[model samples]
Target: MSQTNPMPNSNETPTPMAMMQMISSRWVSQPLYVAAELGMNEAFMGKLVDLEMPVIAGGRERTETEYRPLLGAAGFELTNIVPTQTPLSVIESVPV
Candidate 1:
């Protein structure tokens, strides 16, 4: 009798069904934490990045609320936003 594997064959390109099964499975995905210079004017450093990022990198700084939907759309849940003494804030998220 041929055994049918429940896991996807990594050699082959993953189909939408395989991807969905992986997500719905009991596999625990790793969390993502990003320490970014967010748009908080606590030390004036955040304002600097907020102003310069758009001109220099064509990316604007974002608030925690602004990042919620953005991250959520990518299958991650915005768990926590921890602010440091500096302008940087740790944005924590877990995969859904």
Candidate 2:
């Protein structure tokens, strides 16, 4: 009689979430890779990067007060402006 191993294969397929995360990470990191290759990352050093946030409150608009403190705590200041028809109910940001 031949002996058989009972452990699962180490090369098992990835789950749906794992696959999605891999794909999304590749998509998001590719640009960064190119930027680094082109020396753009160094050029943008010591600059304030603009961050965007989308706020939707049950089909109603929300005030900056609702998000300012949170962003402030994280070292970001509210821009006090919302883009028109951007699908985002509110946009907030902080300087990194």
Instruction: Report lDDT (CA) for all predictions.
Output: 0.62, 0.42
What's the TM-score of each model vs. the native? 0.45, 0.29
Candidate 2 regions exceeding 4 Å error are 1-62, 86-92
Whole-model lDDT, model 1: 0.62
Where does candidate 1 have its weakest 10-residue lDDT segment?
A: 24-33
Q: Which runs of model 1 end up more than 4 angstroms from their true locations?
A: 1-58
Give me the displacement of residue 83 in model 1, in angstroms: 0.6
Write the residue-wise lDDT of candidate 1 on 1-96 in tens digits.
Answer: 343444556678665445434554524244233455556566587567778676533486688788888777657678888878775567776667
What 10-residue stretch in candidate 2 is worst by lDDT? 46-55
1-96 per-residue lDDT for model 2 (tens digits): 432322246487655444334434443233211112233353353231222112223234456786777556544576755453323334545353
Superposed Cα deviation of residue 92, candidate 1 (Å): 0.4
TM-score of structure candidate 1: 0.45
